[model samples]
Target: MRRMPTRAKVEMAAYGASAAALAVVPSMEVLPAHAAAAAISGGSLWWLYRKAKTGDFARTIRSAQRLLGPVTGGVVYAAAAAAPGRPWWEIAVALGWGGVMAAWLPVTRSTWTPPAETGGPGYPPGFTGLVMRLWDDAEVAPGTWLEDIEQTVSPEHPDFTADVVALAGKPVPRLSDVDIAAAFGVPTACVTLADKPGHGPGRLRLTVAPTRRRGGGIEEVWAEVVARPGGAIPGSKIVHVKTFPAQGDLPARGMVLAEVEPGEVARINHEQLCSAFGVKAEELRLVAQSRGREALVTLYESAPLKGARRATRELLTLDAYGRYTIGTAHDGTDAKVHMQSAAGTFHGFLVGVTGSGKTVALALMCAAWALAGLANWVTSARPDAQMTAVGRHVDRQGAGAIFTWWMLKAAIALMDIRGRINGEVGHDFSGHSPYPGLVLVLDEFNSLVGDEALGDEIAQMTDVLAREGRKFGIGIVFAGQSLNLSKLGGEASLRDQVQGGIGVVLRIASASGGIAARQATGGLAGDVDIAEIPDRFNASMSLMDRMHGTVDDVPGETTQGVGHTVTGSEAVMMRTLYVHLPKDGSPDGLGEIFPEGGGINTLTEREIQELTELGLWHDWTMPPPSAGGDSGDAMPAFTGVEAGGGIGTLAPPPVAVKAKKATVKEQVLAVVDREMTAKEIRGLVDAAAGTVRNALSDLVTDGKLRQVDHGVYAPVHAPADV
Candidate 1:
């Protein structure tokens, strides 16, 4: 009395009709019953076999039924034919065959179908599934290679187990961040993530879409809960997914999903992303952005410092990025330097250990200023130190501190005088100033700031200068082996001010292996990591190519100047220019002052001509600073090139001397009777970039004169005020 399936009911009805036909029509008995039985059996077998092809159900039984149907029908015919009128035998065979069909009937069912594969990777089965994947050699798929195994493999191959690795331990078709996110029971777009400074993982609105099974076509997803990772991403909370159109280079337009909230992207950094994808450390770039924590990422084809650039006059203005570049970030864009503010209110702090290119940094910045028609006021406690190079191009030497109180007094006097001039003229000059701004390069800050006798005064001077020199168009740049807030001076702390200041900190280091890596990059310390640099002791191929298109253009170990600026909270590696300074002896004995193989090298004939044309190069043999070196006509640079060909070979240039008996400083001090200014004394002495200012300063230190006001100095005999 049970209701049968539709197919069963139809077949049953047909069977009854057929029975009725045979019984009702005696003449139909002439129509063979065996033939009718054979037709019915063939149709049933064909239909059942088609059902077997679609799903896993009674496969063996279907074939048996196909064979049995014909055999039983034939048997029925045989019994009827062999013994005519023994129709009971044929009836018994037919009933038995029908009973067997009922016992062997199978139901239709669908098997597991996996979802589509994603670019990141797919969710793989667990360890149990891995063990089950082994197959015999014959059953292995063609052209499929087992990873990490050099040869073809079969299931549970003995040799494979012994020799195979996980291909650098990265699992293929394994659960990835994308897969895990998708498995969160929602449709989500998985964003690839990595850790990086400046631009890295940050807040992003990701549309989370659950991933469907691989190879599953048009199948409904989210039918089951997604399997989450054994360990969740730290601090991440599940958010509802959002569907979007195809964006950027995402895999599909089908269901662009965002699975996380904004700011979630920020948490994913270069390291995390690399580990997740099993890629190398540098494959991704979190390039510095003009604004925002979300910087644009780009892949670089090659090293950013692959080439070198020289400092040129055209690169002198604010329109350009820096006084000179240190190098480039991993991303090939210029690591443009921002040394100080427009008002010269800030200072540049170059922090690096010895051999890390501190001197190179100094020269690069100074050279840029010198080339731009800006003044370079450099100083070193040591006269013969490498810091002397920048002063070579200037009319007067820019070095020599001597770790004495006199040194501090001279600096204070110099800055005080310049500060007053800036106050009078104001910082808003249209064209350039005779001294556009003072770039006071302190070579050994520790030496001066840590000096036993003058350390405190020097420190105080540093703070005073930093506090007040900016509006007066003067900026300070400190470089030394040892640096810290205590060495910087001032009662209140300036550590935060310097660290979180408006200046570029060129963080430098060069250790290929070990702990340097751990301490290599971080906030304010190393925002950018400088990869391998061209030899600082030699000219690089890029430099050569830039000059002559061949190594022969400018050969030898030309010093390299490389670093990274942690300005604006972002780090960018940079390669500063190889500045060209006059050779051996310029007016201030400034030429050839940097380390033999440092940021500033001796000017070649071609470079000398270029700077000479701009009137930036000095012809030392023509006159000394005490003479008319600052105001008189300069001889061609060629005339000053030493005959020995130390950067040049030429005869000495012409010169003129006043033949005055008094020393230059003597004349300057004599004129300070009624509070004479540097320029007034210079005119009285008839000298240029003359020794007057220093003479006045020295006389004050010697108690022979007093700094009455600003640049004016009064002799001991003068009035109290002037």
Candidate 2:
């Protein structure tokens, strides 16, 4: 140690003298005065000590050492001034004066060490020692250093943040290069990294909110419970503790996600998981593993879906993003379905086993679409389908008419759109009114598509519409137990095309069905085992529980619409909006959805004309009144005299056909009794160019009239237009 300077020696002497005086002053006073002085001095010191412990003051060893002189002098003055009945303000003033002097005392300005000055291989002061050690071991950017560290104090589960700086010739450490929880000594799922907004680059915020372990052995207990006859794999550990929401004043429920060492996942069963988590077997759910390396251990306090959520009409309306809320997600968040996205309109596939709420979900979606101004045609295998609530809003229903209706409507729409695009009359179609969006609902799709007579053709037509219809504002919805390739005509790619919009997998009845759904959805439904969903929601009655009379009289609420909705790569658990449940004597759910007199979507007169002119229209489908006949084979009545040269000329009709009505084609030919150009004939007949041209071509093909000139047609018997 170096010799002390004279000035330092003098300061040390003054501090000693003041402390010694403070000790003697109390004893030197009279008994009553001494007692009063002692009380005043002791109370002040006690308050300071409490505040210091709570971190309200900078009270380190070094700081206390430096502050000793001022503290002793304040106590002495306060004690000496304390008469038996002295005013409280006198003691307050003395304490305040002492605090001012302490602040003015020469001491180191910093309470914590700066990172740069904390040289050598030692960890920075105030940092968690474990974090520094792991950071070094991980080699997270060798030449990078941490600084400006911030930590949450006294938090139930704490978070830490630091600014990263690079040394000469080294890059800053990035968050992706290191697993935050591994390096930070917390659960992987407990670690979250976010950018510190407005802090510029190289600033990372890490939140490590591990669920506070109970009995200080949440993991240790879990490990002991899961231990095998031999032992757990060396590296296996619980890597995640799921955080739960507060129920009333307590936590809702809890779970843990653990990484079972490779090859050990299969060895563990639901019993082990339940025992490990301290939950009953029925209350435990083994969520699907990831790459066979992890096991999700869940403990449910109640059914995930408590009860049926009615699909109110307001819930069917679209938001600005063209999305609508269908139900609540498993995490108690809103589950939304997008009608339109950046990619395009999404087609839907609703698949589930019987009693899985598939029909109710379909009804909900259809009603929503109708309210959103989309045209709907719903077909069901059952004649008494439970869709009466929305029955009025749909254009058609019934398996017999589905294929024909879809083909005609789709063909007409496609033709009209193509003509407009090719003719440059309009750009690509965007969904709205008049030509509102179109959806073909195939309810009980398996029964309808499995019919031997219609199956192959229906499959082929479905493929066509799936490929081409979306661009023209037409979408198809297939609802059934499975949308697997075999059910969809064994066309491997058809499911992908049709389900590009939304996929709902409700409670599946069998293991194979789950496998088929996994293949059909391409695992977009997350890795969920659909067969287990109903069991998770339904109340359980084990043999022992039943023998002991512990089972509820009424079992679980039906897990009807409880299923998964494919959002992206992950499938989210959700309950479909309950549109309606048919009753014996009550009215349909339609009154609960649509307004009293809300009409269904239909084509306008102009749209009708456009369809007819394309020759895509079928007689069995809607026909214009001008066609004047219901017969599919009705021909244009000829009003002409037969010419000798195989050319028939049409003058005006001498008499209208009284037996049957003439078609639009006959009216067009009648307008061309004399020589007339195609445009002139179109103007007189009040028809589109395409329609007039089609009529003229048919008449010419039928040998009713011959072209007299380049742009004009003449009656074959007329004398050269003289």
Name the top lDDT candidate: 2
Q: Tell me the alpha-carbon RMSD of every candidate.
A: 27.7, 23.4
lDDT of each model, Cα atoms only?
Answer: 0.42, 0.57
lDDT minimum window of 10 residues, candidate 1: 150-159
Estimated TM-score for each candidate: 0.38, 0.49
Tens digits of per-residue lDDT for model 1 on 1-722?
Answer: 23345565554444444434333232234556656665666666676677677776666565554455354544444445556454544555555555554444434321223334324223235322232233212222222222222101111111111111123334222224444333233333322222222422222112222222331111112111111232112233322222222223221111111132355432223333223222233322212221122322222222234345654444433444334444444444455665454443446666555555566556666655554445555666566435554555542444333333332333344443444445667653223543455556666676666654445555666676665555545556666543544545452334333433233333235454112322432122323322323344233344446678553555544224545565534445555554543335444322333233333323235433544543335422222212125654643333232356321221221233344478767777666668667677777885556356666677789887778779877778777764
TM-score of 1: 0.38
**Candidate 1 — which residues are off by over 4 angstroms?**
1-292, 295-302, 316-326, 381-385, 395-408, 418-435, 489-560, 579-722
Model 2 lDDT tens row, 1-722: 23444555456555455444444453344677556645655665665676578764555555565545545665656555554445555445445544544345455531322344334577644345545656677765676656554432121334444556566555455666236566666676555555666654555544554553332235554555564443422235767555454454222445556676656542334344444443444432333233256655444445455555677878878888787877876556667887753456557777778788877777778777878877776776555546544566676554443344334344435534544553564545575323667777777666666654445545555555666665667677777775533644445455455444767777766454246557544343534434346544436677688899885777655677887776443355677877656745356676676544767765445655655553333433332122235665654533222433211121212222244456768877687778888888888876678887888888877878778877688666767854
Error of 2 at 694 (Å): 55
